[model samples]
Target: MNRCYKILRTVALTPSIGPSSIKIVGAQYFARAAIAAGEFNSTRDYASPFDADGHGSHTASTAAGNHGIPVMANNFNYGYASGMAPGAQISVYKALYPFRGYMSDVVAAVDQAVEDGVDVLSLSIGPASVPSGPSAFLNVLELELLFATKAGVLVVQAAGNGGPSSSSILSFSPWITSVAASITDRRYNNSIRFGDGQSLIGTGLAPPTIGGVFFQVAAAADVCQRNITAGLVESCQDADPFIRSLVRGKLIICTYTFDFESEAATIATVADTISKIGAAGFILTMDPDIGYEQIKGATVTLQVPRVILNNMESSSALWEYYNSNTMRSRSGIDIGFRATTRILDGREATYTWSAPVVASYSSRGPDVNNALLETADVLKPTIMAPGSSIWAAWSSNSEGDQYIKEQNFALLSGTSMATPHIAGIAALIKQKHPDWSPAAITSAMMTTANFSATPGVPILAQQKNKLSPTTPFDFGAGSVNPSKAIDPGLIFDTYFKHYVQFLCIVPDVDDMSMRRAVGVGCPSKKTDWCSDLNTASVTVSNLVGSRKVTRRVTNVGELDEKYIVLVREPFGVNITVRPQVFKISVNASRHVTLFLVATQTANSYTFGEMVFEGNNNHVVRVPIAVYVSSTLGF
Candidate 1:
């Protein structure tokens, strides 16, 4: 039976939108599989394409899982879960196992997926870093994707988790659509109210204690009096050391340290320890040495009332309150445990209604060329989508994060979660406009993204611990607007040959490398400038005095429309577009020239946009990024 079908047998979901039917097809597993024991099993090769790790299932369902499925875990209904395209079909190509796999296996999977005639290819994987080459764009993975694009497959990939840092994008080829992660309007928070009437906020997904009344608190160190334990006994790892009488009805405080991060300790074990000792509930405080939202399995559902103080300040305050109230002897033996608190039921959901913020972990870009980090004239990630705290399908095994096991659903985060949103949206577009090329589809999305928001509210990006206005590097064309994209009046389409020509002109790439990468020699006629490639976005990594580039836009709408060009010029560059106002008939194309001149030398990158607003309610936007080196030098 299909893996998804097996899961539906257990879901008591009254699905409104349906997966109606999940027919598994073209299922193949090419990599050596790894089971839960962390041992490689060669005999498992060519087995069923079942998701041993929940990550693949989460991503797969995010793109095309059945809609209106109630997200249930720990016997609590958090909310309804849905995919971008519920009616779409899924074909599994298992390249990597739950734990890890080789790049060669990944290559085989991509090649096979393309051969199997899949419409869209969504990959939540990429190179660890910039691949070794004169031009990182020519790596084996990039070349395979280039060929896939040539075969009319829309490839979407994770933009890497390297983060708010500049020039950290891993997706290099313009042919592939790279995706950045964003936090959604939904927020998950739990609070603990102390006896003094002060409440401290924390994170968790669990039910509240049986009653609303405050319960006495007990420290793990006091209850688990293990004088000769090997690990951090305060972590509450073992039930043997616990003084059950003291912990039976109290909210036990457990320490979260690096051990939890390394899997030496786990939230599952802590929950087990709490159960074994019959404690009323548990509070996991951050170990000062490792603070901030680094708690793994923090979102896992616990049957017991639980709260994870992920922030240092909140953990410190809770600790301070506990220490001040407790009376201890000179030898540090607890004489009295007086801290009292009640954990609120966190299973209920809440909405912030705030605009999606670029996740602090999503890789930013100026699309670099080499390992030295020379910026390239390409934009990445091409778009952004909700990737943080997303609730999606999970394999009960939970092989990826062992701390979370035997759950049919999971709340996960990463750029990996974002990539499939674009892929699913692209599939919808392809279904509507069967004749549209991959480039046309990509342009439609780029030009119409970030549309569903209140006017004048600039989308902000999370930097380290602060929020700032996002740039093209932070979110390519902004968050994707699927509705507007389906009717984007104008699209900048690219040809496979254009990519070949662009590769020939890349800064350090040579003819020999080009032959090896693409299986073809450079065309006799050399392209004048790399920026001339017809893409929805324009970027000049190192601009000097001035440069002129031309872009051709095709009318993809049903009627002729007149459009006026608008420019939000970059800080140090002045822009001019000829034939500012023009009309184009349906199925026709128009070429526009943009003249950019250096107004002042800017040592850093500055951002801007060029918009084409049509009379027929179609808006096309193109992001521009430029780094000015010198006013008069190359």
Candidate 2:
């Protein structure tokens, strides 16, 4: 794993595992485990830094996995595996355990990582929902992250996968870079062919090819137990002897019944039953009411060909064929099977229908933190990354793992997969510019992100597979462009104190909680609220007429550089910047005030952008969103 990731340091903080178990080439290793596992929490365990669950290794390797390692899955070589920052080094901190980890253990890990002087912290875990009130302040993870940010460590966290729903982002704190998942160019497209010359498209992993092999198909209902209970045979859940006898040497069709959906219709359960009964193959049809939509990836590995038919029309036709009179008179219907094909040799293609779309499960936000206060609600998923079906290094020890077969590399998906990409990018940026602050690095990435791959077309969403316009809430500051980010002419930077001030402006958050969070008291003077925040993005809510927002930009480019402000005003809103053109010397900064006037009240949120173009072709863009009283409730 170290050879693949170019790991600089491998640290083990568990009592059970040590440095010897963690194999890394040319990497300094360290171990520090708290021996008193039960002292911190009852759930705590003294485990080794070795990744028993395989998640830690996956994420770590995704961030800095070594370059040019052969990538294989299910004994099929796909390509070479490399991380986003393969040149960068990784240092592991074993803070998690199988399934769960104690909060105290995680805090200890964070404290140690910060103390050890790591450049960037990639945490793939988060609460399912935003914590409220004092709980928010008391959250050990958030508090530790605050300290890390204060110490100039770039913290990247997963915007939890509880998504496809608005306000589902869990890492709500503004100090950390919360990432959302998006589909990459690569996908596993499986095809199913029937004897009727009709073919259907589906998705799965390691589906057996079975090259033109034709087998007789039978519905599970046709192989019911004699005198079976009502609905038992139809559900196809039990492994009864009669059902097994009927299914042996035949492809079985499984459909979702009420009992199956409620009790036994998972992919694992269905696949296990089919394998145990000696079925030649399995065809899983979607529930009729749910309509058509193929499950995107593999849920489990199967020895036999397994195809999921999500299209309602195709599945309905198959169901009819299974119960047809011709089939009833005969022993069973003949079916032909073909395995999924890998397009572009499983390489990513950005311009295709599936490319550059937000993963259906990626979290969305108009961050629910401080939801009651219009000014305090922050935009989350600081950015999107390639998170779907990413191929990266896997733990060798975790054989028979559900996510990773006995291979050096595995394909996985989640915001967890996306967070490390940014972390690795941050590490690269840090290497290029050692003096840059975390906020400056964040601004560089955000201000220079590409919103669309093609001209006049915004990035598409994977779930809808359409080119619908998305908002900042959908993809905050668009997607990260590492090459452009390294030389962003100007950056909107903020310090820890700025966040404290912003928090102070939040309604219902008391000073006591603020002190507990930042270890600082609110200033005597009132903060400018959200207007004072110098973020790369601008948001103004509940605007009745006009409001002035102050922002400062620091020039990080050549000396004597001049930047001209270009405003794309939101609909019904007039935007003007005082001193539209300004000059700044290297290492110098300038402040600009934006005067916004609402020409008409907006019943919904409106969006625009301000572009600062430098003479040298360096551009820094800031997205602007405005909401009127009618839309303030959001």
Q: Which candidate ranks first by lDDT, i.e. highest?
A: 1
Question: What does the lDDT read for residue 540 in candidate 2?
Answer: 77
TM-score of each: 0.91, 0.84
Judged by whole-model lDDT over C-alpha atoms, candidate 2 comes out at 0.68
Residue runs of model 1 more than 4 Å from their true location after superposition: 1-22, 32-40, 43-46, 132-135, 226-231, 238-241, 258-265, 289-294, 370-373, 451-453
Which residue window of length 10 is worst by lDDT in model 1?
1-10
Encode model 2's per-residue lDDT on 570-609: one tens digit a residue. Answer: 8878899977999889999889989888787767678899
Candidate number of the best TM-score: 1
Q: What TM-score does candidate 1 get on C-alpha atoms?
A: 0.91
Q: Give the C-alpha miss distance for residue 525 in model 2, angstroms.
A: 4.7
